[model samples]
Target: MSSLPITLSAMDTEVRVSLCPSCDRSISCTTTVFPAAEDFQPPQDHSSEAHGTDDASPLSRARRAKHQACAIKSEIARLKSLTKELKAHHRSLVELSKQQLALVAPVQQLPVELLHEIFLHACADEEIMLRTIPYTILSAMSFSRVCRTWRNIALNDSRLWTFSTIIDLSALASAYSRPRGSWIGWDEVSTFKRLVSLYLSRSGCRPLGSLNISASYNEPALKAAVDEEPKLLPPSIFKHFHRFRDISLTNSVIKWAELRVRASQESLVKSVKIVGHNEPDMSTVLFSGAAHLTSWSQYVDDFVPVNLPLSQLTRIVTGWISYIPAFTALTQCRALKRLELSLYREFTMEEDLCEPEILELPHLVSFRLCVDNPCILDDILDILDTPCLKKLKLSWAPYSGVDARLTDDFSDWEWPKDEFSRFMDETKCKLESFTLEDLCIPPGVEVELRKQLPQSTRIVVEENSGWSDEEDLDLDDLMSEISKSDSESA
Candidate 1:
């Protein structure tokens, strides 16, 4: 066979060859027309004429076809290697372009001051900071890992590390119940303690934003640690107590005694929340020198005496106190701007009891009252005179015992409409917001209550007793705004 001509085109890049044999006309074929190895078929015969006599026999043709296929496969493999190299080069160029573009990104061009503010905003989520244990430190570390500039900024600016730190020792306590040599591995506990130390050190001289420590009293882990090992919390943490701004200790009674001992030194603490089965003594005056203490909250089973500087407080939330004691406590909180009280059980009405003297709270702007019995609500409202009150929230949960004969359901109970109206008129206060939770008032009564307040006042009433599901006003935000305004005015 002899080759006549070869043709090529841009659209079809494959090389086309024309062949002319001694006894045949011209035939055209492309390089890609060669059959793959699996598709190729060999002659079945092995006679002398097929193999040796004629060069154009089936055996000779098969051998030529096999040789051609081998050569084509070698060429195809070389081309594949070249294609792969080209693709790798293309990817490198793309990555280089992306890096160049990132260098001139708008965020990268922002001034350090603006970037600092943006970072603070990113870490301003208080709920996440409070709920997730050690997340405050983890979040700061994450910001530092972004880039060199971020790392420099995050490490230098102490505000990023000032989020509320919540250390929960309940898990550690549970881990101690195992066999003798197997306490929850010390590596984990050590790592956590190290993180806490690192977090505090990065805060510099700035006041600690908040510190929340919770552990159970029933767990012997804490007491055992105090006796036999180093404390679960690093000793360095207590050294910074004077700089603590907000503090919460729950369940562990020993921590309460520690705070009482350091009360005079905690001059920077602004808020304190305590929750437990029992606390130190009723007569013990904790935080005696905390002049900045403006908020106090306690959750206990019964009414316990407390000797705080109530005259200077701006916020107070008490748990389960009798009406007489609650009223007496309010009379001392003359500077209070916000007050919340939870009264449990029934109040005995004695005929010999004299009329309660009216208590006036001139600076009060917000009040929330939650009672299990509705019978004493009228008497409570009659005695309170809040001239500056702007927000009011009333929650009712009917007691379900044989002695609590007030009412089984809120719908059957009578609302103190006349008493509340008379109180409003007597105080001459303009309420900007009002809320009634867990009280299934009739539609008609709701309309009347709405009419008593200003038309612009925001009113919320949950009739089905599912108030927790609804979005109520955030009192903390309100009080913060008020405090800010007060400071600006001062």
Candidate 2:
């Protein structure tokens, strides 16, 4: 609180004094002037004269200054480089985002049902390659290239590969499962494993309709599937073998012997046609599942085989006719309506001595005789003695340069006209149908033969006008034309 002394010298000195201690020069200020106190110490004065001009301190200061300058410059350069990198990174990110958006936009427009139809078409035709479908659709290419949604759809469609319609077994084995090039050696295990995996995957998939495992050497896998789980072989697979309807194979898959054991269990199997080396020793239980069987054609290699009791058989074609001594053995088949002789060799010198007894099956409605040579008329009349016989089909080729009288080696044995008429009358007009093919009849005899078949709807008689002694005639075209004409007439 005591009044302090205010001097003019202090004011003037303070006004002149500098506040900046680090700077080289003093700054001007407008304020009340006060003289600096003598006791108050001032910053130390550093002048060029205080230090010598030739002192090493100057060089050291320059070195320090250069180091500081370089540090500052380096920091600035780093900042610029970082800025350029950041700009480049931002531009790339923007471009990538645009491309992603472009790819995603097109896929959203496709309908789910359209994709389903493509899968269906692929199942219908096995030959169609998956890539042929549109990119927007679910194809192998689209699934790989496009987004995840399409890939899921394509991979899920199991029917895509199930319809392996390949006819050639070797080609199919090499295509999907086996190695590309020729496989040599015992290292085929890999191929087998791959095939099993492929088939297993397909079997698990739904809607697989038809399958043909009839190709060669695949019988093991096929028979195993049928034997182990007959249900796996859907009815549709059997229905696909339209051309092979008349044929059956029960033995080759495993052995007709083994098949007889599994026959009752195979409810899916309608009919099976097979040729056995020996007569089947199995009981009729093998035929239990084949309740739907209407026809059976069996060829046994044994001299005499056991007769099959076909309950529902409407037609029976056998190769043992020549082996049977007489027709008495064939009458055992109660359901026999049609009989086809597989080894019916026309009257030969070796066989003529042991002529088989004429088979007169009372229930026989149709008879089919396949002959390598012309058969005698009396042999046919003996078979036609069955009153139920309505149709007769003969498969034979007429001999070249054979007269209508049948005097040549291929001539059909001729009986008197009265005897032939008597045999026809004895049949009681039961023979309503007759079929003859690949033969030449004399011009006048053709008309007479037609008159003999009074009730026949099928008449196939061809006059061999081209038969000559020098060159053998190609009867293929003529036979084909005759068949066509007969078929049209029928």
Top-TM-score structure, candidate number:
1
TM-score of each: 0.61, 0.43
Summarize candidate 1's per-residue lDDT along 1-490 as a digit string, tens digits: 2334545434324553333222333223234433456646675565744554665566676887777778679657744664565456558767988998788687778899998998888776432222244543466778888788889999999988775666666655444455545535455566666776786788887777787777666766766644432456655677676677888866453344465345546467899887766544443255656788899888764645466778889998877777767766778889999999887655543532465577889999999988887766777777779999999988775433234433345444578898899998999999988887766554456667666878767777654344345554333344456679889999
* Stretches of model 1 off by over 4 angstroms after superposition: 1-139, 142-155, 176-185, 216-230, 251-266, 279-284, 345-355, 398-418, 432-461, 464-490
The weakest ten consecutive residues by lDDT in model 1 span: 20-29
Highest lDDT: which candidate?
1
Give the CA lDDT, 0 to 100, for residue 204 in model 1.
88
**Cα lDDT, model 1, residue 186:** 54
**What's the CA RMSD of model 1 in angstroms?**
15.5
User: Backbone clashes per model, in order?
Assistant: 0, 7
TM-score of candidate 2 against the unseen true structure: 0.43
Whole-model lDDT, candidate 2?
0.45
lDDT of 2 by residue, 1-490 (tens): 2222222333323322222233333223233332224423333334647565545655565675565556556646744664565456558767998998998776656786687566557545443211222223323334434567665665666555443321222333333344446342113323333343443354343433222233344444443443433322222333223212223443443242343343324332333454445535533344444444577655543233233345556776665345233244455555668877643334533455464444445677887765434454445555445557677765543322233332234554443345446656776645665655443334344445456656333554323321333233323334456679889999
